[model samples]
Target: MTFQDYFPIWDKLDPRQQNQITSRLVFRTVQKGAVLHSGSLDCTGLLLVKTGQLRAYILSDEGREITIYRLFDRDLCLFSAACILRSIQFEVTIEAEKETALWIIPVEAYQSVMAESAPVANYTSELMASRFSEVMWLMEQIMWKSLDKRLAAFLLEETAIEGTRQLKLTHETIANHLGSHREVMTRMLRYFQSEGMVKLSRGMVEILDAAKLEGLRDGL
Candidate 1:
């Protein structure tokens, strides 16, 4: 897909402004396991994911990595939007989950584009608002739901997103996303497996009965 396909704001720009902005766009390929940015690094412009997945995480006091968010293809990594606006340091580490392609624009370039077009600024603001709402919803889910309910909800959501009952997530990855211990997640998965709600295969989890999983959510 072209840049305009990923960023609809580009389509709203006039020819002159679009040409100027597109000319400055740079593409970078990140290998699997590469660190896009560390916690101590300075925050710059946003990193738009064109393909593959990325994880934003932080190191806890006990030296455990706690995942904050996951970015799939077409997601933008803006972990430190405030820092980027204020020209400060970032506090999150962004890592590539697979070989990824990203578009990197300098802060000045982003500012220039925003300044040139009111629609671009409005689009960005909407993006930030959506991200904020997602984070808030995730926080509420963690605080209000039990482990089983959370797992069930996650499975259902993933199924809808993947358009299939089979999911390609590991236990450790699920634990990170749920903000729980791996041992807890393993036990939860075992419970689901024994109840015939899910099946565990080689590094993958498949929902055997989505209706039963949905039933568990009502009990939450």
Candidate 2:
């Protein structure tokens, strides 16, 4: 799909306005395993995921990568208010998990477009609010849920997206996403396997009993 096709705001603009805004947008293709943004670097534009997946993570003091979020197609990377008003550099590192397409819009040009279009301004505000709510929900989940419960939830989510019970994940990657240590995840997975709820094969994990997994989640 074209950049405009992915960003519906393009349809709301007049022909002249569309051209002006389009001129400032650039499309770039990122290869798998590429680092799109680093936590220490300053990024002045917004990166919109047009296709594929990006992992938003941070490096710990001990030099381990801890995943904070994942961005899929149609997700906006840097919220407009955070980029413009607060002038805060994005706290997470964005890395391409697969070959991905992205639309990069300069912050200055985006602000100019918002100034000229009330609809765009409102959309930007709404997007920021939604993002904030999602972050809060993630925090709540981490605080309230047990590790096993969180693992079950993550497995269900991955199954829904991948359309399979088996997940192509390593213990380290799962640990990073769950904000736990690799050794901890290894022990938990072993327990789940012993209970016949899941099966581990090489780097893949297969959910063997969905009902038992749901029970674990409900009990948490």
Candidate 3:
């Protein structure tokens, strides 16, 4: 798809603004494990995901990672352009969760357009608010929910996203996403296996009973 196809506010901008953005727009692809943007120091431009997945996360001082949100096809990522979004203080690392195709609008160009266009600025605000809401929900989960419920919810979410009962994930990887230790995740997975909610393999967990998993996730 072209820039116009992915950008919702394309028509709102006039010819000059459109030209400004298109001139600096860059199309690129990255491998699954590639780190697209690291920390709050690098202004990596505004990321428009044309295809595949991206994970946005933050790391603690102790090096534990917690996913804030994820971007998929047709998603716009504002946090990548941290220089333009000056209010964002925390560090966020964005990585390619799958081989991703993207259109990057250089921070300066996008910022210029945003300044000139009310629609673009409004869109940016809405997107930022949405991301912040997701982060708040994650914080609530971390603070109030128990680990078992959180893990069950994560597993169910993965199953829905991947559309498969078998998830090819290691304990370490799952722990990184949920901001926990691998050993704790392993113990939880073992408990789940004993309860017949899931069957664990070397690097995979297959859901044995979705109903039971849902019950656990919902505290039913």
Better structure of 1 and 2 per TM-score: 2
Query: What residue runs in model 3 are displaced by over 4 Å at the alpha carbon?
Result: none
lDDT of 2 by residue, 1-220 (tens): 8778777677787787777668888888999889877653455478888989888776667777666678889888763224574655546677888899988888777778789898888888887777667767778888998899989888888888778998998998899887889999999999999999999988999999988988898883
lDDT-based ranking, best first?
3, 2, 1
C-alpha lDDT of candidate 1 relative to the true structure? 0.78
Which window of ten consecutive residues has the lowest lDDT sum in model 3?
A: 81-90
Candidate 3 Cα RMSD (Å): 0.7
Native RMSD of candidate 2 (Å)? 2.3
TM-score of each: 0.82, 0.89, 0.98
**lDDT per model vs. reference:** 0.78, 0.80, 0.94
Deviation from native of the Cα of residue 170 in model 1, angstroms: 2.6
> Using alpha carbons, what is the TM-score of model 2?
0.89
Distance from true location, Cα of 62 in model 3, Å: 0.8
Best by lDDT: 3
Predictions ranked by TM-score, top down?
Answer: 3, 2, 1
